[model samples]
Target: MTLDSETFRALVTEASLSPSVHNTQPTRWRLGPDGRVQVLEDESRRLPVGDPEGRDLNVSHGSAVEGFCLAAGRRGLVVDVGHDGVHVAELTVRLGGVSDPLAAFLTQRRTYRGKFEGGAVAHAAMARFEQSEDLIVAQDPDHVAELARLYDEAGLRWFRNVPYRAELVSWMRLSRRHPSWSLDGLNAEAMEMSGIEATGAGLVLRPGVFETLDRIGLAGALVAEAAVVRSASAVALFHRPANEAPFDTGRRFHRVWLSFTQAGLSAAPMAVLADDTKARESLQADFGIGGERRLITAFRLGVAPARDLAAKPRLGLDALIV
Candidate 1:
């Protein structure tokens, strides 16, 4: 059956809430003439430098697709998604859907980027994560510190790439004065950066200033996230079957994150660990990731201080539906 206009709007709005690289929100929805919904990619939002292979981009869309499906389930509707090898998917919706338990945490999930509270992660929580076949938790202080160093090395390596740095900064909403601060991309507040820190980031990420800082050996320390990573109660490595498509991987990615939220844990993705070949290989070898598994990503997991943060910035329905 065709989705009513109100239902369509509601579903698309919830779907848009799914996270994306740089918060680009590249997934677009179309109420096709045949009543099925068409999921399309907005090529203009592609992160050519940061995600040259489009793996992350595809993953972003996949998460949106899962979001849409979950939203439908919440309304007692089912979405049968049909996807070939292409980037697009057609969703067939109907009644008689069971709501997903993880859907309860969707609205509560945030990419917590700030420092986590100090303390050992609860044994129960750590045990739950450890029990998951797809996850490996590193709670050893030495191992976490080592991972932090490797993360910094990988981050600094990427920071030196001119185009990559430029592409990242372009999506950064460093000031509340920036026009798109509330619309899309990474805003300073969500990043947990103070005004001065935000301003400094804009300057530090500039090629010339970064070069000078690196020459003096200050850039590495400046860009380092070791403190943040080391503060985590534990780090998790997310892995999947080696040949699984990223779209499928992304579906599970969102679910796993929502599970973290349900367990009273906050997390932030450490993409550098999975994106850098050396870092990825190191993690796979050290973590005992079997040959049949692909290391998808990593996360720093911990309990965050209670605070009422601003709502996530997202484009309105008009911008998402075409």
Candidate 2:
């Protein structure tokens, strides 16, 4: 199959569905006159304040590239991918090999932030999962209890900050009347709680809901953590050297993240433990991480439970295409 404008566009459309840090779709793509796809950083989409450097941006790029690779495979194009910078990865796709069976799972994969079926993610599978150098999975219930506390503490610290809260509110897409907001921020429907039908509104912590969320957030994090620990499967934590640029590390982090998704195991990045310094330092001590290596992202993997809420919508190709 030859690379043409329409085919390339279709490939990119499929690729954009991949997950990223904060759901920030930071990767930018351009097609050279020579017919190759060129990807670069759209610094505007970057979370400079929260991410400081472009670490998260890079990881987002990696995730995007992984999506592209999967899309290419589905289209019967074999891809050669590699990094050009903290902000970029160059990809060349050509006709080749059998399509990956997991390629179909890309668009279907979602960051299921609800309950997981109680069970263990087989030891053999867990062992294979640990093979990624930058990843870790915690599936012990006691560990889940500890991790839940960590996630709660992190959320408490994050939501308490006026600027952070403001940023979160800004990204929220509250209603169908305003469609763009859906592109980013946490969707209310995605949160697991009672008395609320899964609605794709912005993270609606209505007045009294804060206390409930406080409990649910803590419990959900614990449940997620325990799911990983109990099923002997929780999530994969990715990291690279601390001195590396944000963009550089992020690219690598997402590559591993999406690979897990393509494997039929659903995952979502959890940077709470990584972003919380005191927590990260303690984790370093516990996980035996040393020598200036730092955590980049973590993902919880498990079977998604069915719910009434609809899947979060994505911006149409026409709007996202540039």
User: Which stretches of candidate 2 lie above 4 Å from their native place?
Assistant: 81-90, 97-102, 120-127, 192-233, 241-252, 262-264, 307-311
Which tens-of-lDDT digit does each residue in 189-302 have in candidate 2?
444433233241234334344446655554234223434333324655666787876545644554565566566565555677788787778777777778588876566666
lDDT of 2 at 264: 50
Best by TM-score: 1
- Top candidate, metric lDDT: 1
Q: What would the TM-scores of all predictions be? A: 0.97, 0.78
